[model samples]
Target: MLQQRQDVINHLAETPFWSLIKFYMDDEIVATDRKKKSGMDLIKIIQCYDSKQQKFKFGDHEPKAITSEDVVEIFGLNNQGVELPNTDKSTKNMKDSFVKAYFAKQKIGKKNDIVEAYQKLVQDKTPEGAKATASIICVHLLQSLLFATFGTYIAWSFITICGALDQISKYNWAKGVTDYLFKRINKSKKKRKNGEESATINGCIALILYWICLHTNLLETISGRENMIPAIGRWDITKIHKAIRDIRVEEIEISGRIPCVEPNESIGRGIPCSEEPTEEHSNINQEECNDIPYPEQNNESSKKKENKTTGRKRKRTEVRVEEDQSITITEA
Candidate 1:
C-alpha cells in the first residue's frame, strides 16, 4: 500500500496538468473553514472604477490603475496559449463528443458528473487513468477558483476542454479569466452610471479582493509561508470579510503600486510588501519540471527519509587498478 501510494504520487508528478497546479499550490487540503465571506470592499472599489481608461478613479484627483498583468501575477496561471474557444455550437459539440466517449447516456448526468467519471477512470490503475485524474483536478481547480461564476452548473467551455486535457496547458486560461474580469468590470461601471442597483458583480470577485489586499491597508491579511507560491486557494474568505466589514468605499486608499504587490517586504500597511524583484515577472519556472515533493513518508518520518533520499547527490570514482575497468557510482 505504501509503495502503491508513492507510485500514484510519482505518476501524478510527471503529468503536465498536475505539475501546473502543483507549481502554484504544492500542497493538499488548501481549503479553510469559514463563517464569513469577503468582497464588500472589492465591490466598493469597483464602484469607483472607470472602465474606459481601465483605471480606478477615486475622484478627479487621484487615479490608480490595475492591469491584466496584475491578475496573471497574483493567480500564477498560464500566461500564454491559444485563446479559449467560446461559442454555443462548439460547447455543444464538445459535450456530445465527451459523453459519447465516456458515459452511457447521451449527456453527462448532472453537476459533478465529470468528477464521477474521473473517479471511475482512476479505478483502472493505469498510467492513462492516473493522468486523467490529474487533468480533472486541474480543470476543476481552474473552473471553481479562477474562472468561476455563480452557478450549480459547470460551463461548457471547461467541459469541452476536458476532452483534450493532456493539452490543457495549451489553452490560454489566464487570458480567459482576465478577459472575463475586464468585461465584468466594464459592465459594472456602466451599470452604476445608469443608476443600476448593485448587481451580482460576477467572475471571480474574491480574486480582485485578494489583489487589493496587497495594494491597500484597509483589510487585515496574512503573509503566507516564505517562498510558497501565492495559490489563491489558500485565502481565508472569512478573514477578509472581518477586516473590511463596516468600511465604506469612501475610506479606501492605495498605498502600493499594482502588478507588483510584494509579499516578502513590508510593502504596504495590511498585507506583505513587494520585493526588489530578483526574479522576472513570470511565476512558473518552466525549466524546473520536477519540483513536486514526494509524499513517501508521514510527518513523523519524512525529515529523516528526505535527508537520506532527496539531498544532493555525490559523485564517487573508484579505480580498479587490478582490473582493466574503473567504475563510477553516483548517488541516486
Candidate 2:
C-alpha cells in the first residue's frame, strides 16, 4: 500500500493538469482497472482513500470504504462519472485564435492613432517652426516607445538620454525666442521695401537671440517674470547648463553682425540702415573712389559719410594734389 501510494503521487506529479488538480483535491488511487463495472464505483474507491488519508496514513488507515452512492452525491455525476462534456480540441484552438485576433486588432488600432497624431503634429503651422521641431521630437519619441515596447530597456534608456541632451543643446527655451523673432520678422517684412532680405536678417537674429536666451540663463529669468510656456517639455534647470555649454559664442557674434540690432532695437530696425547702400549707390561709390586722384582720401571721405550717418565721430583728413594739365581739349 505504501508503494502504491508513492506510485500514485509520482503519477500525479508527472501529469501537468493532474498535479495542479491533485494539490487542491486530495485523493489516492486504490485500483487501476480500466474495465470498471461502474465509473461511480471506481470514484467511490478513490474517495474512500482520500477521506481516510486525511486523518491517517494510506497504509495504516482502516476506515469504512466509501460506496458508489457517496461518489454520485459528492461529484454530482451520473453512473458514468460524467458531468459536462469535455471541450473538443477544435473549440480550444478557436478560443486561442480569437484571443490572438482580438489582440492584433487592438495593436493595429493603437498604431493608427499614433500615426494620425504624428501626421497632425507635422501638418500644424500655427506656431511657425512648430511643425519642423515637432516632427523631430515625434521621431525620437516613436523610437523610444518602440525600444521600450520591444523590451530593449537599455537601448531605450540610451536613446532617451541622448534625445534629452539634444533637446537641451538645440531647443532649450527656444519657443519664446523663436516666436518673438517670427513676429518681428513678419512685422518688418510688412513695413520694409526689401521684405525677403529683412525677413532673412530677422531670422538670423532670431537664431542668435535663441542661443543667447538659452546660454545666458535669460530664459529662466523671462520664464519666471512672465510665466512663459516652456519649449518642448517641462522646464529643467540642467537644460540651461547644457545649453550654455553647447552654445558657440563666436557663431552668435557672426549672426549678431548679420542683423546688427542693439539689444533694445527690434529685428528689422537695422535693416533700413543697410538698405540705404543700394547696389546702384555701391557701384557709383566704387566708380567715384576709382576716379578720385587720391584713393586714400576718397576712402577716408567714404568712411566719414558712413560715420556721420551712423552718429559716430570721424577724423578730418588733409589731402594735397599736384595736377598736370594738357592743353589739348576735345569739345562735344
Candidate 3:
C-alpha cells in the first residue's frame, strides 16, 4: 500500500494538470451528491481533461506553471516562503495583466502578474546604453594612458643628452620623440597581428598621434592653433584632426584668406617680415606692409608688426578753410 501511494504521488507530480482535472471532477460529484452523471456531463469532464493536457504541454512552465512568487523565493527575495508585498499597486496590476494574457492564450489558469513581474525584473537588471559606453571609454582611456606614459618615458630617457646618445647615433630630439611614438605604434600593430583585442592600446596610439601632430605643427594647416589644444586632449586623433580641419576651412572661408600649408612645405624658407615704406605717400605704405601676408602667423608677431608699422607713419594731411573764404592747406 505504501509503494502504491508512492507511485501515485510520483505520477501526480508528473501530470499535475490531470490531477487538477480529477480534483475538479471529484468536486462536481460531491457538490451534486451523484455517483453517476448524464452523457453531457461526462463529455464536459473529458473536454476539461483534454484542455488541461494541451495547456500543460505547451505553456511556458511544464508540469506546473511557475509563478513570480516561486522565482522570488528561489532568489531569496522572500524569507519563510512568504509572498512579497505589492508596494506599487499599478505595477502589480500591469504584471497581473501580462500573466493573464500569456496564460489565457495557452488555456492555462492564470496566476496574477507572475510573467509580468519576471519580465520587469529582467529589464531592471539590464545596463543602460550610455552607462555601458562610458564604462568602455573609461577602461580604454586608462589602459591607453598607462602604456603611452610608459612609452613616452622610455623614449625621453633613451634620447636625452644624459643618456646613451651613442647607442642611437645621428638622432635629434624630434627623432627621439618619433621613435618613442613608433615603438608604441608597432607594439599595437603586433597585438593586432596576434589577433589580440586591445582598445586601450588603440586609444594610446590615437593620443600619441595627436601629440605628434600638435608638436610638429601639422595641426595648424587643418585648424588654428587656438582650437588645436582642445581637440588633441579628447584622445581621439581622427576626431581632433577632423575638427581642426573643419575649423580651419571655416576660418579661411570667413576671412577670405588662403589656408596655411603643411610645415614641411615651408621648410628651409626664410622667416617672413614686412618691408617698411620709404615715404609716407608710398603705395607700399605702413598699413599695407603691416598686414601679414600669412594670416596663420601667430598673433604676437602680427601684433608687433601692426604696432611698429602704425607708429612709423604720421597721420594723413587735413584740409583747413580760412575765414576769408580762401581754402588753406595745413598739416594736421
Candidate 4:
C-alpha cells in the first residue's frame, strides 16, 4: 500500500507538466544568480578598460584588481550566495577590534540575534534578490489562495513553488501529501463516495483555465514566460496544456460512470471503479479472483483468501519415493 502511494506520487510528480513547472520555478533562483554574475562580469570589464585608458595616456598606473568588496559594492554579490574570498581573514583584525568595542557598548549576547543582525547588515540590493524574494512571496500567496478556494489536490499543483518547501523539507512534505491524498481516494472508493473525485475534476477544470491564462498572447513573451530560458520559449507550455487536457478528459470520462454499491458487484478486481458496466461482463466477472485486500487483511492473508476463492490448482513438486515403493509421487 505504501509502495502504491509512492508510485502514484512519483507518477504525478514526474509527469512532464509538473516536472516542467518544477524546473521553471527552480530556475528562478538560478536565473537571478546568473543575472548578478553577468553584472559583475560587466563591472570587471569596465574596470579593466578604465585601467588600460589611464595607463595609455598618463604613463604608469596601478590597475585596480577586482575584489570581493568591489563585487559586493557594485553588484551586491554577497547576498546572492556568491563566495567572498578572504572576507573573514582580511577583516579579522578589524572584526576583533569592533567586537571588543561593541561588547563594551552593549550587554546583549544571543547567538541568533547576532546572526540576524549580521544578515541584515549584508542584505542584498541586487535585482536578483528582489526578484527571488518577490517570486517566492507571490507564488506562496497564490498557493494559499488556491488551497482556500479549491481542494487540497488542486492547490498541490503549486507545491513546487512554495518557498517553505526547501531541499531538506520537500521529501517529507511530498510523502505526507501523497499519503493524505491516497487516503482520501481510498476512503472515497470504500464508501462509494465521489467527493474526492469531484473535487479532483473541479481542480483539473481550474487548472485547465489557469493553463489557458498562461498560453494567451497577453501573458506570452513576458518575464515568467520568455525569461524561463532562451532556448525553450514558455517552457513548451502547449505540451503541458495537452497534458492538462488529457487529465481533464480522463476525469470527465471517469466521472461519467455510475457507481456500483453492491458488495458482490464486480467492481473489477485489481482496479477500483465506479459504474459504467462494460459490455464485457466475463472480464468483469474474472475480477472475482483479483488480489484486492479486505479492510483488515494484509497481503499474506489476502493472497491466501484469493487462493481459496480462485481455487486454481497449485503446481506439484516432485518427490522421490523409497526404493521399496519404487514409485515417484508429486506432492502438491
Best by TM-score: 1
TM-score quality measure for candidate 4: 0.20
**In what order do the candidates fall by TM-score, top score first?**
1, 4, 3, 2
Clashing pairs in 4: 258-275
| Full-model lDDT for every candidate | 0.44, 0.24, 0.24, 0.24
What's the C-alpha lDDT at position 225 in model 4? 50
Clashes of 4: 1
In model 3, what is the error at residue 23, expressed in angstroms? Answer: 90
- Lowest lDDT block of 10, candidate 1: 319-328
lDDT of 1 at 12: 48
Model 4: per-residue lDDT, tens digit, 1-332?
21233332343243312332333233321110000001111111121223222211111333322222322222121222212122111221223332332222433322222233323322434543333333232232222211211221112223223322222123322222222323332332333333322211111111222222233221122245543421133422222222222222212111122122343544322122222212221110011111111110000111221121211221222422111111122223
Off-target runs (Cα >4 Å) in candidate 4 are 1-19, 22-170, 190-332
Clashes of 2: 0
Error of 2 at 12 (Å): 44
Candidate 3 global lDDT = 0.24
Q: List model 3 lDDT by residue over 152-198, tens digit each.
A: 11111211211211222232322222233334344444554576543
lDDT of 1 by residue, 29-115 (tens): 121222222233344556676777766765343676655555565555556779877611233452455545554452422235655
How high is the lDDT of residue 285 in model 3?
15
C-alpha RMSD in Å of predicted model 3 compared with the true structure: 41.1
